[model samples]
Target chain A: MRPMPGNAAERGYALSEVSCDALLREFRKDFRIFAPVRLEGRGRFSDTDMVRYGEIRNFREMELREKSLFSPKEVLFPPSETLFHFAETGVREPSLLREDGKGLLVLLRACDIAGVDRLDAIFLGNGPEKDPYYEARRKRVVFALIECGPLGASRSGSFGSCFCVSMGTNRASGYALVLRPEDDGLSLFLEDPAFAAYLPPDAVRTSYAPSFPLEDPFPVRVPDPGDMSRAVREESLFSAAFWKDYDSRCIACGRCNTVCPTCSCFTTYDVTYEENASAGERRRVWAGCHVDRFTDMAGGHRFREKYGARMRFKTMHKIHDFHLRFGRHMCVGCGRCDDACPEYISFAACIDRVSRVVDAAASTGGDDHDAR
Target chain B: MPRDIVRKKITKNAYRITSKRAETCLRVRVPGGHLDACLLDVVRSIAERFGDGTVHLTTRQGFEIPGIPWERMAEVNKAVRPLLEALEVPLGVTFVDLDGGYPGAGTRNISACIGNRVCPFANYDTTALAGRIEAAVFPHDFHVKIAVTGCPNDCIKAHMQDFGIIGQAMVEQDASRCIGCEACAKNCLKRVTGAISMKNNRAVRDPRRCIGCGECVLVCPTGAWSRDPRKYFRMVILGRTGKKNPRMAATFLEWADEEVVLTVLRNCYAFIDAHIDRSLPKEHLGYIVDRAGWPAFREAVLQGVSLDPPLRVAETLEFSGYFYERDRVFR
Candidate 1:
């Protein structure tokens, strides 16, 4: 079920109100459940009260939010994943990595679940080669969507820069359950009967809400996908002056790419042992368009030498370019990038500024609008 | 208890060298984002001799010497000890982690912007203040993030840090020194704040409207406007981005003096000591504050600390994030 306003078909799911602690306790007995957990101190990325995905050890620790600062994608696609390990000779097969035998359960928001679907498209479906590592992690997991309300400190559902409604990712399906806030705890709605076995044996069931709030409380709209593509075209924006001012403002911190749930780019390297050069491991780590070495190639020709060019590439990929190639837009409109940016660069604001430039350029018929 | 148990303390110590196996990167502290040319040679020599040839310029205004082998940590430490002395970093007395490896995973490297020493928008000396803070807070096994910026423009992003210190200046206008240049008024009206206006061939400043960014001081040609010798700061607390919620920090102190700020910092330590759970590996001070409730936290942090007049403390901190009220998870 979606939020309120429009009737959200429960489909085949059974909704029941129960205590959050109780729900988590029951789930923990059977599966490895991941939830939003507060860090004890400075985490890997930042020093804020950043929440990250961790195993739910305590029933009370399973907290929900409007959105997490970082995505739960780390559970499926880690910041670093070792593809294989090699020994002696040139290339020996990779050593086996440990895997949790039991299935996994994750509590996610609507946009994040949609982000999972977008990732699934690239790694699991309609691709030339399916990633076995990603598939292994993805196939064994279950998802439960959290319906966001006007819950203070629970600002995970709607973001000021969010455009999920416009992108048609506001409502999430294909999950095992959908949770809505009841008086003190949560109303656990079960979609897949297989997951119901994890609920308390004596638990009685209720029905999910017929509707959910379709539009974001505060939505920032982007231009038509086709128009956005044209606006970001080489001919139109190559010489546009709007993106030139970021040289001083942007420090290329790579915070945008780290916080984005849809970003799936990775850079791989071989880590050979000093004692035995023959024994090495191939590791895949996270990489993004904002970092300095993102475009560096073997011949020393960097495609995006300028910061603005890199910013343009990132923006186009997020809003227009990726959507053009893939049937669905890569961005889930979660708006984590805006919150995570230290320079306070708003990707949503870029669309507004770029749209005006595109309109002006279209009207003037290639007239230069350099304000620099 | 010996710290460094779960994972390597590299991330907490501002060292990120996961790209290479068995190699640790050391994030050399550069207070206020400025360093002497002499220190560069020291860093370069160490990098070339002990580690890889490349040194990364971290976004936090520091240097990261990557590719240092794990075994040469002590040698690297000895070579770089003099550079730390020049930077006035507290060595043997405090923050002496990294003997065998970076073991302590608490206080991060202090970050600051170039203040009045360079930038026109600055109000106070940011680098000097960052050094003082590092002296007071570093080497502890408690997680804290502090950043100092010269003005409200917030180049260093003071608001997002665990302890944010933003500089502010009180401006005074001397009518006798006014030459009617109108430069101060012009800048105030356009770029900065329109807190000053030309009246009767002399400049009059509106104290309430001024943001104290020192725009008037920079524009004054005849020394008509000057900054007050007294230093002022605004302290913001508890802003964080995490799994459950992400919210900017709320102001705890406005127009506070040096003593009040120091006392508060001291009390933060005391409060953490009193309330930190023994079972958990570590606990963020912000989370501790949330779990302890605002009343207990406010009283503990402000115990015996007197605030200067007109410097108000927040009566009710309007935190916009979620925490577990039904149960505590640290155990």
Candidate 2:
């Protein structure tokens, strides 16, 4: 149903009461609740049975304010799922198949929210009918927006962070429990006044003031899709020197795919029981595009083998090629690729660097100026 | 007409104009520009005016319009000349399957993961290696799917491709960090060989017992651990656990180069190209290898290498090399 302010059709609640009873009850019915928690000396989103409301004392207690340490893509599209159950005879049927009308609830920072929206455009809107399995999980949930307050110290991260401000995803308005703490305790702003009445005095500070963008002007601009093909072709002229540096630092963890909201690729397997060889489950799990084995079809003919070439595929798909084919950038600038990277390969920075090279090359008009 | 390649539906704005009476299919793409929208409309209008009112989406992410007769090819090309320039989309010999054969499964052939640079389970830089392989090998007509995963978790399913590589960690567990917590002992599915008996309820891993899946590393609460920076990757050949005779692939090589990997892949492809009849329809690589005899063919095609004992003599009809052709890169 289309969202409407509470009146005859719907109603609002105070943020505190939403957190106290209503929110927890509503959340528990569907979601396996998750919030930021300290685990093994670091903070992360993990499942805990400690509180009925799945406690988040304040925004500070929330996991990384910059963006989620992990992307919520796993909530719907897990690392691995059973594609179907099978027997040795080649006959099979679905096992643990998720129903089509399920939903999920995620506490998302603005960047990831944007990422999900981008994913919606790719997976649900433009392409085929949303994958029935993915759609079942996607349609079931809602988003709870959390505003990022400030950057942390040791900021080894890039100055041109994939900030929500630049990505046009700094704030959310669909279904939120905005927090503002005052004297009584913590004040929660809710949609329903009845939910609001249950709040302790001065517990929640309610204000309509919206946070301003962290920096004045958004620094990044998407490279035009029209210029991509020639730019990519030109990039191939450069030798392996440029690629070797990036490859040296790479650790093939596949986290960037996991954290990316729009990375919808997957792989499948037919898992069978040991004793009951007649029965096994077929599983489909998320697969990354940046792996050595990803392109080896039959007979060992690998299509893309150079580090530079793989980088070319990723950047082009995100900015150029995908846009040409699907009319949208595959990336939403969530910056998870930057943060999740231990060696700290920033996708945004990479794009920015490549775009400069492309622009310079384009201006030269295909002349071999550097290497004679 | 092949029923497999029949007219499923007719959509507009996908392909260039087609003739009203041709047996073979002709696909034309509009160039890339703002005029793409306009060209889409123009192409759609033309298709309706001359032939059918629909276009087909191919696995390579291109569009095709059928019902074109051979005689009208020149006329069709002539009619769409202006629009082609404006659109900037090129049309040529397009393979029906380019990406993963299943779009629902994701990008195929040259698939790469984000890698350990960002992931918790990473043993090494899978992205770098995957990228290295993608660029160096130089592709052939038949797409070869290569997969790379950073750790034993096998997140990318590297073991399932024609050629696959998975990163493994060299690690040692400190006894002092052992809290007797059964988490590591319990979480391990491989039943790693190295583990000190549980004491004070905490279990310690014997360096020898670890298969290096890192499940214990992930679950361990005590910070008592040392991991080597030099995580090694194991190369796996021919592993597709899919329909039509699924099988688990075996390890082929270990500790090879970015260059060595490329050399082996190129040589293998050259072998397949030389031996397999391109004119005939071939379902998979294993099928050809099975029919052709593995040892004799390997001797002829992959001349330089010392053939692994298991691969050379394994009797399983489906060799590990030719699995499934999922994405644009067929495997």
Candidate 3:
């Protein structure tokens, strides 16, 4: 893979300028562009001004200023997707939806790309199961990187629970194209020469500058493994006040999971048509761990009976368990959960509290060490 | 066609699903979780015309109709127009413009504990109060959650809500008419908060510890410790759970009356309107308040509101019971 813009070699790295309108028209020839667009009212993401990834008609409709309220991952893994059509006789996969055309996802920020990487790890990596649905959709997606607000020392570079700089997810690689708006116009970084033929003859040369700074622009601290591993793995941290407190506070509304880019947990169901019992469809819909029935299993045993326990499991997985296997934190620190939660539960703040409590326990000679 | 309707998870009023192929689910917002039983037919119409003739009861005590096609959302909304119109509230009337679609789901349906209307331990009628609040705040585009519980038994889980309101009845004991039954003292110690005790054959309240839950007032058969005529509620602020720190709301106002609560709530909108970050997609009220320090927020919410004894605001709120400002170590 090529080094990110500033560090990459100039040869074959032709930086140019393209108006957003012309770029959208050019990209439409090759792939269907899914960009962030504002809806008339509260869309699926539920906020009035929410920006969500959707198939766009014009570049003017694209919302690029703020982070997408809903993740672009849905382009690959839909909220509710039909797996196949079934019948009394036999089952068969539905006609491939991608037959319309390949999809081009544009303006994905650093944390979002990181989110996609995590999704790839869970869905398409060297895992026991490779999701054919996600794999098929993922194969046709053309990734395009978009730079966030103009680089400046005056601002935090991130807003509202966003801590990508501290989470080490402020930068990403592996994109077919990069769009960074400058004082003049939208600067286009064309790394792949394969797309050079699509560019206009007037495309100008420009050098890429690092946006904001690679380091944290604010005081926000990222979750640390040191605070978690010792107290979470070695000690019974479940008994802490953190886990017990959320029982009443978490209403199990499941908005947090729906807004979360990394929350990939899903539940599959079969629905037979009423008109024709012989014909049916097996579908997978987004399921939230925070939901009370999410833990119900065979024989009536529930893994996470209480909301607090469910919250603990979710927090531990995002900050600890996933990291133990992937060597990286699962959370991209987008803070959409904070914006989405009606109860005002701040997942970003929970990471900090969990770290503090765990680190405190680690330093204070935890009780019942003999058991650990 | 509405230009930006992607017809994904939900439309304005309908929840779009992909089960058995694409479908739309209609959500019914019954304020205070209490609606006219006759409205069932409006639901029947929606279920028959737009849905698969089935309704799903939501945990929040509302109703959801399943299996309407995504394209038929407008028709579904049109069918439910009567039900939405029947609400008769100015907010509800304006909200019905979406035809029957949930008009900009900013204000959530208020959930309340059945109070003095039925329950014996209630300090006040929760359903009535929730309806009052719902009318005052609905159809707005600011995200604020309010839950009302009758007494400290907290069956409604008030502490978890953004603006958790628990009814409180200030106990005024008259020693002259004491029965010396020690009922108030015994109940206070056994079931209620230990804020009362028997002293000289009279129930004496520890003013400092009294959460004003009114258990003593309820058990006082001799009427020595009757509730003060003024209705009051304890207000908790901010509570939330998220990526960093999750916290139960801190007590903001005690012995607050309906006027104070309403004023504070209305003022909250003013504060939010003034401070919300337009650059971001959306901002939580708590986040906006956090940006403006608690003191500034306090001033903003309590601008014209007045308070007296038993209704005094904490000099400095220290939410030690759970997480908030001080609980988290991270930024």
Candidate 4:
């Protein structure tokens, strides 16, 4: 069911801290819950900590204040997944289900929920044949939407790099549960009727409505997908002088791709065991357009050698190309790429630049060369 | 009339007799080369009031106020009490008289590079370690020089000192997180030792060639390579610069934890006291180590110190320096 703010009173329930723990304990029997957790001293630098998604045992382990350095896409689409194992006889698919046959319950923010929809478009609805490896995991996954309130005591309207409101992804629906941290306990909106049975009988009925962030500290103007598509067809945006600056700036570290929730590109390879050369497993690993050798062919030839070309390819794919095929822009504007770029390249600024270029080209009757 | 200045007492008080007959210079010690900005007012007032209104930044990361009259040494010592209390007293250095200025000047100021507090390349806080070293070895007349560098880059010129403490990072990789991007491998090959190589779509590090510079950890995009929480250090010993011989230090200990480094450094003083040539007014630590062979020196310093499994002690030291004797240099 699509949960709306007006009808939240009909579905909302308040649970004490102990009751919430009890409810999670009950849910744990059938679902493996994943949420952002703090990993001490696991950051890129020394004496630093990073928050990333991991299988959480209880609510106390979840890091709710800060945005996770990585997205929850790894739960449904892992970094490396083995499709099947092959030997002299025949091929056998790896067991896709968990040992307990438990489903996946992910706690994420609204923008990431939107990001999951984009991933769905690519993996499940991109072409005639669905990706079997992704489908098996996708079918078992559900979401718990975490309320994006004023971030800690500082009450910063949004994370500095996020522009989810500008991209119209600040609000999301179709979550099994909606959780808001209250002073005494937790106020939950049980949107999916199936989840109400899992709640403790002691849960108190309450009138509560979760609010979505309407503004961001950093906002971007996303170009109209139709205008971007037309610009792509005319080849104006591809050859725009704006992309040349990235040649010197970007280090091609692929951090942006690895952190992106919607980036779904992968490359398949076969690995043979050292002991038995004939016994091997076919695996698919996440690939990024910015990384080296992404477009390498059989010969020595490669595409997008200059970092600028790779930036252009990624920008068009995120804003224009995928929108043409899927009826929605692939980017959810979570701005994780901005946060993760070591070179400090801002994807939000790039989107604004694309909007300017597209507007300039349209205003000049599609003959603008100095649009940048 | 000529001034009746007691040179030994004045020198011990951190006063330098300058070329001018009656003028002297006061050297202020700044451990770790890091100090509060408020302490600069004391230095500025002292220079303006006592000296020729000028201050020299010493090579050892200390402040040297020149052109001070020798007769005003007493007043200058009183003026510098604040500096002493701020920089030295807090580091556990005990002062006989807080108003008497520096108790000893033979051991130079412990210099350090901008460490993990500022530089991304640094593995640990060099300034903090330098302060600890200062606390352990200061207030003595050893005529020894020591420097701490954040990494193997040796930015503080630690190789030119009697004792050089270099930061080391124990880098480890998580194979599952690696995407075979080769960023770390490429950076290591180009800028550092080629310790990492890509094999089977993952980085395989050769620990033998790894200098523990942490370039792999710095350049990694996926954070597959990270520094171990426990800090380690590489100690290079007996490098010196003088008219007799000047050479870079060689590695004496590798993968030494903080306790081992501190104990070894503290024990070096006793080794020097036992073997120093008393005929001369003062002897550098390097010359004493040269007079006594490396084995004797090693034995003396390693007394009561336990070497952990990961710590590697040097089996032998081969010093590369030139003798100033004409017979040895003549072709």
Highest DockQ scorer = 4
* Over 4 Å off, model 4: A1-7, A10-24, A97-100, A150-158, A180-189, A193-208
Cα lDDT of model 3 by residue, A57-142, tens digit: 66567666666767777777776677998887887885664454556655677788888888888888747888888877777777
Can you tell me which runs of candidate 3 are displaced by over 4 Å? A1-18, A43-47, A97-103, A149-158, A182-185, A210-227, A368-372, B1-331
Worst 10 residues of 2 chain A by lDDT: A44-53
lDDT of 4 by residue, A293-330 (tens): 99999988999999999999999899888988988888
- When summed lDDT is taken over every stretch of 10 residues in candidate 1 chain B, the lowest stretch is B1-10
Tell me the tens digit of each residue's lDDT in model 1 across A88-148: 5555443323554667788877778888887787787746898777887887888877776
Docking class of 3: incorrect
Per-prediction TM-score, chain A only? 0.84, 0.73, 0.86, 0.93
Error in Å for residue B246 of model 2: 55
Q: Residue A345 in model 4: shift from native, Å?
A: 1.1
Model 4 per-residue lDDT tens digits across residues B1-331: 7679888888888898789987999999999999999999999999999999999998899999999998888899999999988898889999889888889998899999988888878888889999999999997787889999989999999888889999998988878777778888899899888999987677899988898998887777666788887889999998988888888888999999999999998999999999999999889888898899889999988888788667999999767887787877787
Task: Sort all candidates by lDDT, best to worst.
Answer: 4, 3, 1, 2
Cand 4, B chain, TM: 0.97
lDDT of 3: 0.69
- TM-score to true structure, per model: 0.50, 0.46, 0.50, 0.93
Once fitted onto the true fold, the runs of candidate 2 whose alpha carbons sit more than 4 angstroms away are: A1-22, A29-37, A41-66, A87-103, A149-161, A171-205, A208-212, A216-221, A233-241, A368-372, B1-208, B211-331
Clashes of each: 20, 114, 20, 0
Task: Classify candidate 2 by CAPRI docking class.
Answer: incorrect
True contacts kept of each: 0.00, 0.00, 0.00, 0.51
Task: Say which candidate scores most in TM-score.
Answer: 4
Fraction of true contacts reproduced, model 2?
Answer: 0.00
